[model samples]
Target: MPKRKADSVLEGVPKLPRDSSIAHHTQADYIEVNSFVTATPCDHCLDSGVPCMIDRSRRYSKCASCTRASRVCKREFYTGREWDLLRRAEDKLSSDIEKNEDELDLLEPELSALQSRLTELY
Candidate 1:
């Protein structure tokens, strides 16, 4: 049997293209794969006592360590000074909503009283 030549070129790197002798691996590919990994657990996971090591694949799963509906990793969106600003905005909106609800609650009886008075006047 004649000796095959392709085997010798692919001997070192298994995934390298068989047609071409060049390998196309890049540092970015390794970094992208490791993007979901964290040296420490996310704060939500840690605070909840689960200390979740969130993987990108598992972020959308029901068993994710964080309770947030957002699929985005908290580190990506809710980190640094931007996170602090988001928290402040959330708190303000919550306060405003509660205040409006309370005002509506207070208006209900008054509206009923005015309706009853109008019924009597009519």
Candidate 2:
């Protein structure tokens, strides 16, 4: 029969203090929640023909329309599968660079030898 306070709903919840008023709903709280709800999708998701919608509850950033793993979302906004893909891509790029460097090293010697032969012939 009595009117319950807005903060009464948060009773027993850890981190948040009890006796806090609904009026205590700060601008920061709204901003934080809004950020969780709205985030930019990653480039992969954009390119994959999937709309990158932010899922606050998703362990991985998944497509809101297809529920598929989204590569366009950031780790903060979306975790799990898509995050793994981003990491793997980074690793592959590093490996490719190393391979290119190795090839260049091999070519350097042959290039020097060719130059030396041309000089001798001249």
TM-score of each: 0.39, 0.38
Off by over 4 Å in 1: 1-75
- CA lDDT of each candidate? 0.54, 0.54
Quote the positional error of residue 4 for candidate 1 in Å. Answer: 8.6
Write one digit per residue (lDDT tens) for candidate 1, span 19-80: 32221123223333533545455556555665354435542322243333233335433446
lDDT of 2 by residue, 43-91 (tens): 5545565444544544333344323321233324456777899899999
- Give the number of colliding residue pairs in candidate 2: 3
Among the numbered candidates, top TM-score falls to 1
The residue ranges of model 2 lying beyond 4 angstroms of the native Cα positions read: 1-75
